[model samples]
Structure formats: C-alpha cells, structure tokens
Target: MTTAVAATATAARQGPRPRGLIWTVLRVHRPALLVWCAYVLLMVGWMLWVQHVSGARIRAELDACRRRPEGACIDVMTFSHSMNEGWIGTFIAYSSYGIAAWAGAALVGRELERGTAQLAWTQSVTPTRWLTVKLAVPAVALTAGTTVLVLVYRWFWSADEVLRGDEWYYTDPFLNRGPAILAYALCALAVGALAGLALRRSLPALAVAFGFVLWFHLYLDDHWSELWPMRTITGTVSGHDLDALPASHFWPLHLMTTGVVLTVAVAATGAAYWLLRRRTR
Candidate 1:
C-alpha cells in the first residue's frame, strides 16, 4: 500500500473518538497561555494594592458624606483610586477582552497566513478536527482568562456598594455569566477564523479582526439592552439602605444578539472549511 492509503486506513480504523482539539492547540501555543495568566495576576495584584492604599480616602469621603445629609458630597463606591466605575475594574475588563480578541485573531490568523495550517491539515487530521483544535485552544484559554477576570472584579468590588450604582457600567454584561460574554468571544473568534481563511495574510487578518472587535464592543457598550436582549438589573441605595430590583426588561435583545453571534460563528467556520477544501496549494 502507498503512504497515503496506509495513513487513510489507519485513520479509518481509529474510528471516531472524543478529542480535545482545544487543549491540543493550546499546548502547541503554550506561550500565549503563560502570558494570559501573567497578565491576569498582575492586574489583580495591582488593583488590590491600589484599592488598599486608597481605602482610607474612600472611607473618609463616605464618612464626610454621611455627616452632611443634604450636601454636595455624596457617598460612592470607589474602584481602586477612581470613583468612576469605568476607570478601574471595568477598564481592566475591557482591556482583558481586547487582549482576548487579539489572541483569538492570532490563533489561526497567523498560522494560516504562515502556511502552517496547510501543513497541519494535510496530516492524518481531518479538516473538521484541525479547525476544531484551532478554535478550541484559544477559545478555552480566553474563556478561562475572562472567567478569572470576572471573578476578580466581583470579589474586589463586593465590599463597595457605591460602585454598584452604575450597574450598566460596572457589571459589563459582556463579561458576565450570560450570552453577552459568549457572544463577544465567539464574534471575535469567528471573525478571526473567517478573515484568516479569506485574507490569507496575517496583517490583513489582524486588521479585519480588530476592526470587527472594535465595532462590536462599541455597539454593545452603547446599546447593550437595546441590541442584546439582556436586561440590566438595577439596584438602588436609599438613605442607609440598599435595595435590589429585577429590572430585567430586556431579554429579547439578548436572544437576538445570541442568534446573530451563532450565525456568524457557523458561517465563518463553514466558509473556512470550504475555502481550505477548494485550495490546490
């Protein structure tokens, strides 16, 4: 038997087995994982230290505000050294998302552009398996990193109710445990995969992926509930009391955005498959 026939027969005999393509891909790109972890650790430590150093100031301001029942000074939950929710934890979250977006783009975008994808795909691996591994590796890594970020933010801000008032700003529905984060991540991944397959150049793929990510982030930040179907749960502080309310009047938007993300993911993966199959070189 010829080399190709022997390999095909071996593959066939192996049959279908559950595979962790994502892990395999991630192992091949272990440096990305290390960098992701280091970044998360550094951010968490920095935020915590900043918060600790400024804790006295926050308390003093809160005390002063409490003393003056009807004054210009108001009690607010400060994140790190900034009273603005968008400045500290949220900023970190946004940055983390951006990095993840770039990492996703770098996944297959760089490899395919470098012709490494062709080499891997032509192995005993099926196209589906190849793509799955590519997507799975970075997706899992990004998801894990994002999860750490969300947990850190939640833990760090748990003590300060003042920061909670800007529910829309602080919670980052896109980073939360819902369709928003999934949509955002999947959108970035799909764009990267699609761009890599179509453009076949790292720089062009990176440009396209970054452009899409920027547009998506801006759109979601501005019209989250309007375009996402996810409702912002609003909480209120009255006198010395805090009240939590379920103002989740935006479920439809979440569903719509989820559907859009699903469509993009499916289309991008399918297109990549077709493109690779048709390529003669």
Candidate 2:
C-alpha cells in the first residue's frame, strides 16, 4: 500500500502526461507537418544557393549588359536567375493559400463532417478545447516554419542586391522578407479555421478558405501602398530616382500592412471562439 501511494505521488509530481490532446493533434496532423518541414527546408536551401552562388556573377552580367547595350543581353544565365528570383516571393505567398485550404478541408471541417469532432467531444475533451487544439497545432507549426523562412529571406534580402533586385515596395518582396510573412500565414490559419467551423463541410470550406486568402491578397495589392503617407520630395524630382519612393518608406508601409493582417487574424479567431461557444452550449 505504501509503494502504491508513493507511485501515485510520483506520477502526480510529473504533472500531465505527454500523450494528451496536443500530442494527439500532432499525430493526427503528422502528414501536414512533414510537408511543411519539407517546404521550409527546400526554400531555405534555394535562397542560400541563390545568395551565395549565383548572385555576384548575375549582378556583374546584368550591369555589363546595361553599360554596353550592344552585347547579347538575353543569355540563359540571366533568364534563369531572373526566373528563380522572381518566382520565390510568389511561391512563399502561395504557401499561405495552401495552408488555408488544408486548414479548412482536412484540419477542421473533415473532422467535424466525419463525426470525429463530435466523438472527441463525447470524451473528457470539451468542444471548445477540441477546436482550440485544432487551431493551436497548425498555428504553432506555421509560426515555426514561417519564422525560419522569414529569417532566411531577411538574410538573403539584406546581403546582396544583385540579380535579386526586386524593390521593397513589391508585394511578394514585402511579404517574404519581413514580419508580414508570419502575419499573413496566421491570418490564413484563422480565416481557414473559421471557414471550416462555420461550414462544417470539407470541400466547400477548402474552396472558400483558398478564395478568401486570395481575395485578401488582392485587397492588399490594391491598398497596401496607401497604408502609410507617401514621402513627398521638393524640387525637380521628375525622372530622378527620388521620384520613386525611397528606402525610408519601406518599414512604415510594411509594418502597417502587417498590422492590418494581424488584426484580421485576431478578429477571425474571436469569431471562431464566439461561434464555438454558441454551438457547443
């Protein structure tokens, strides 16, 4: 009896077991996690390759082409480098779209539609808790991967302005190289979860979530430039580089847009909780 009591005390001292709801969330979403890992690793490797390997030579050739204008400018190397650098931002942005679709289709809606969520509710897990776990697992995973990506992208963006000479004002460049990446991803997650929970059907939720993300991205494209007041320059700035927005304007617009995205994310998450409470009770 003393040994049994001691064992119980030791177990209690250890706190909660490792095999709980969080672990179950990881297990159920293992495939998605694996895919996220693969994508992050691949993107990091590609960025490093472009930065360290192909950057300097491409910059030299492009400069030479601009200076001479008579030599062959449309070389394969230039084309290849431009193509790689140009699409990276779009690819990174599109990952959020995929995440939103997956979150709606497989993460939340499928569970509810197939009765798995209801079954889990019959256990000790409350309905609210179940929904929280679903959102939290993907949110954590996305944050981790996006953190890695944003760090690597910042490094690449800072190091060399060679073949990858996209301006900061560009949408993809703005997103891939800053905190906005994380904001956009979390926003996608929350919106997708809300779609899943509200619809309770897999296919429809998937389409709606994906479309919603795309629409938001388009909205940003339309209005992001106006987030912060533009810096006006005096004098003959026409045709001068000063006619373009300067480096000084980069962070203000970036931060403002990121803040906007994050606000939407919080609102969607709040709506999710409110909806959950109403339904479960």
Choose the strongest candidate by TM-score.
Answer: 2
For residues 96-145, what per-residue lDDT tens digits would candidate 1 score against the true structure? 34543454357766776677777867677776778767777667766777
Q: Model 1 off-target regions past 4 Å? A: 1-24, 50-53, 64-80, 89-105, 155-158, 163-165, 169-179, 227-246, 250-263
**Candidate 1 overall Cα lDDT vs. reference?**
0.62
For each candidate, give its TM-score against the true structure.
0.67, 0.86
The ten-residue window of minimal lDDT in model 2 covers 235-244
Model 2 lDDT per residue over 1-281, tens place: 99999999999999986477889988889998999999999998998888767876777777788887476577767668767777776788668899889988998889989999889988999988888888888888888999999888888776765555577777788878788889989998998888999999999999999999999988887888888877665565554433346778888888998999999999999998898889888
For candidate 1, the per-residue lDDT at 89 reads 46
User: Which residue pairs collide, candidate 1?
Assistant: 22-137, 77-162, 77-163, 228-253, 228-254, 229-250, 229-253, 229-254, 230-254
